[model samples]
Target: MKKNLLMLFTLFIALFTITSVKADDKPVKNNYRIASDSLFAPFEFQNSEKKYVGIDVDLLNAIAKTEKFNISMDFVGFQTAVDQTQAGHADGMIAGMSITDERKNVFDFSDPYFTANATIAVKKGTKNITSYKSLKDKTVGVKNGTASQEFITKNKDKYGYKVKVFDAADTMYASLGTGSIDAFMDDEPVVKYAILQGQKFETPIKPEKIGEYGFAVKKGTNPELISMFNAGLAKIKANGKYDKIVAKYMGNEASDDKKVDESTMIGIIKNNWEQLASGLGYTIALTLISFVLALIVGIIFGLFSVSPSKFLRGFTKVYVDLVRGVPLMVLAIFIFYGIPNLIESITGHTSPLNDFAAGVIALTLNASAYIAEIVRGGVNSVPTGQMEASRSLGVSYVKTMQRVILPQAVKITIPSLVNQFIISLKDTTIISAIGLIELLQTGKIIVARNFQSFKVYGLIAIIYLIVILALTIFARRLERNMK
Candidate 1:
C-alpha cells in the first residue's frame, strides 16, 4: 500500500511538470493590430461582399492561426497604413510593400514572400519602344514610392525621359489612356490583371527589374511578431498553402480571354449599388452638417465683422483671412493627419479624430469664411438709411440689426447662400484625399476592384450631374419666387 501511494504521487508530479512545460512553450496568443491597403487587388482589397479577402489578407490570417495569435486588420489606404505603422499606432503592415534599402531604415521586414517583376506598357496603337534610345523625350507614368518609380528615376537620364508619379494605379493608367503619358511602368501581375479586366493597354517591352515584397514592422519593435510571420510563411510554403493562395488569385496563367459583356455598365451598377448608395448617403450627411455648422459660424463672424468694436472687426477679419487662405484639400489634410501629430508632440498622447469629423470641420471652416464674406456683403448691400431709420424709431442697435438688418440681409444672400451650398457640396470630394470614402472615393474603390474606370466613373459623374441639376432648377425657382 505504501509503494502504490508513492507511485501515484510521482505520476501526478510528472504530469504537472509536462503541462507546465507545454504551456510555457506555447505563444501568449495576444491580439495584434495590422494595417493594409484597401485597393491593392489580389494582395488586399474589398470583395463584392464588402469583406477584405486577398493574398496578403489570407496569408496573414493563416499565419495568425498557425502562430496562435489574434489579429485585427484595418484596410485603410497604403499611405495611411505606412504612416500609422511608423507612428506606432499599428503592430505591423502588409500591403504588397516592396522591400528596399531606404525603407529598411524605418521598417524591419520579414522574409520576402513575393517576387514581383515590372514591365513598360503603352496605350494601344501607340508607338512601342524597343530600346532606351526610343524613349527619348517621352513621359512615363509610375506609382509613387514604387520600385518602378525608383527604376525610372534611376534610368531617366539614360533614357532621356521624364517621369510623372501618380498616387494610385488607376490614376496612372488613366493618365496613360488619356495620352497624358507616353508610357507607364507597373508590376507585371497588376498590368496583366488590368488587361484581363479589359483595360486597353498593350505590353511592348519585356519584364525587367524584379522586386521582393515582405511584411514590415516599425524598426526595433515587434521582433516576436516578425519571427512568427517568418515561421508561419515558411510553414505555409512548405505545406503548399502559399502556392494555393497564389493560384487562387493569379490563376495558373495570365489570360485576357474573359468575355466582355455589352451590359457591363448595368452590371457594374447592379454589383456596386450598395457602395454607391452608402457613399451618396454619407455625402449628403456631410454636406448638411457642414452647411449648418458653416451657417452658424458665418453669422457669428459676420456680426463680428460689422461690430461697433474695432477689435472684434479686426479679429474676425484675421480669422477669415487665415481660414480662407488655405485650400480645402490642404485644410483637410491638416485637420485629419497633421493635428494628431501636433497633439501627440505636445501631450505625448495620440488623439486621432475620425475622418468624417475631420472632414466636416475642414469644410465648415472653409465655408464659413466664404459665407462670412457673403453675409457682410449682403448687410452692406442693405441701405444705411434703414438702420438709421430703425434707430430713430427707438430701436436699440442690437434690435435694429437683428430685426431690420439681418432679415433683409438673409433675403439678399439667399441666392448666394444656395450657390455656396452647391460649392460646399462639390467640395466634399476633396475629403477623399484623406480617405473619407465619399462618393468619389467609393467610385475609385469600385474602379480598383473592377478595373472599369470609365463605367464606374461615368456612373458617378451622372449621379453628381443629376443631383446638381436638380439643385440648380430648385434654386432658380426659389429666386423667381423671391423676385
Candidate 2:
C-alpha cells in the first residue's frame, strides 16, 4: 500500500509541471518605440551635460509609467524622426511641432501640447533697427528651411527688407551674438528660457503668434497606440504634471501671467521677416551660379586627370586631392575671406567682386574637387581595351576619349555628378559664415528677431526636403539607366 501511494503522488506532480510548461509558451509583450529631435527647448533641448533632457522627455517618462507600456526613445532630426515613424521604424514622435493643416493630411497628431508666442532676441542695446519695418536694406539672418523662410519669401516685396539664412538656430543665434545678424524670431517662452539659462540678448523685440507645438505619429498607424498616448496626455494634464513641468522651467517668472512682451516681439518679427523675404532672390541665384561653376570645373578637371600627359594628370590629381582633403566650410571661408585679403594685400585695393561672387567662388572651388573625382572615376571605368582598340584604329588620343572613352565614362558617373550638384546646392549655406546672404543666413536674421523655432524651421525644412528629394530621385533614375 505504501509503494502504490508514493507512485500516485509522483504522477500528480508530473501532470502539474506539464500544465505550467504549456502556459509559459504564450507570446511575450513588446514595448513600443518613439523618436524625437532634441531641438525644441524647455520642451526639449540638450542639457549642459550634453544629454537630451527636457520637459518632453520628462513627460514621456511619466506617461510610460502610468500606461504600463514599454517605451523606447531615439533621437534624429525632427523631420527624420517623422520619416522613421512614417516608415514604421518608430511607433511615434514628440518634439515641439505645430499641427499645421498641411501636416494633418500626412500624419496623426496629438492635441496641442503647448502654446508659445514668437519673439525676437537681439544684443542688449543695439539700435539701427528696432522693429521689422526698420530692417529694410540691413543684413538680417534666419535659419534656412522653416516657415519663417516661406513667410519672409512670400512677403519680402511687401516688407522691403533683406534677409540672410543659416542652417541651424544655434549657428544663427551665434551670429546674432557676434552682431552678424540684427535680430531673430523665436517662441517667447523658449527664448525666455534661453535668456534665463545665460543667453545675453536685448529685451523684448516684439511678439507674434507663430503656432502651437503638437506630437505626431505615422498616418494610419496602430490607432490603439495613439489612443493610449492621448489618454496618458490627458491624465498628466488633469493630475497637474504638465503645469509642474512648465513651472519647473519658468525660472523667476514662474508666475502664471508673464505673457511674452507683445509690442517688442512683433517689432522684431517685422524686422526679421522683412529681411528674410528680401533674400529669397539671392538664395536661388546662388544655387544656380554655384551649380554652373561646379559643372564646368568638374568636367574640365575630370578630363585633365584622364589625359595621357603625366604633367596634366599630375596637376589635376593634386588639385583634386587638395580640395577634397579640405572640409567645405574651411574652403568657403578661405575663398570668401582669405582670398580677398590676399588680393587686397598684393594690389592695395579691397576685393572688386561682389559678396555673391565671393560666395560662388568658394562653393564651386570646394565642389570641383569632388566633381573631379566623380569625373575621373567615370573616364577610368571604360575598359583599357577600348582605348587600345581606338589607338589601333589610328584615332587621335583626344578623339578616342571624346568619342569612345568619354561617352561611356559619363554614363557611369552621371549619378555622382548629380550628387555633386546637390552637394553644391547645400554648400551655399556655408557662405553665410562669410556674411553672404543666402537661404540659411536669412533664417538667422529672422530667428534673432523672432523666436519661432518650430514655425521658422518648419518653413526651411519643407523647401530643402523638396529640393533634396528631387535630386535623389534623379540620381536613382540615372543609376537605373547605367545599370
Q: Write the per-residue lDDT of candidate 1 for residues 273-383, one digit (tens) a residue.
A: 888999998898899999999999998998889889999899999999999999999999888878887887899876767889999999999999999999999999999
Best by TM-score: 1
Off by over 4 Å in 1: 1-31, 48-50, 87-90, 124-127, 220-224, 253-263
For 1-483, candidate 2 gives per-residue lDDT tens digits of 999999999999999888765444221237767877545566665442234567788788877676666778765445546645654556788866667778788788877777746666677767766777776766566555455555556656776766778755666767787677777765677667767645677645567766777778767665556656666789999999978887776667532212333124453344344555556567667878877888898889888888878999999988988888888777765665566557866886545334578778877878878888888888888899999999999999989988998888877888777877777777777666555656665654344333544455566666677878987997898788777
For model 2, state the Cα shift of residue 404 in Å: 26
Candidate 1, after superposition: displacement of residue 143 in Å? 1.1
Question: Which number leads on lDDT?
Answer: 1
lDDT at 379, model 2: 83
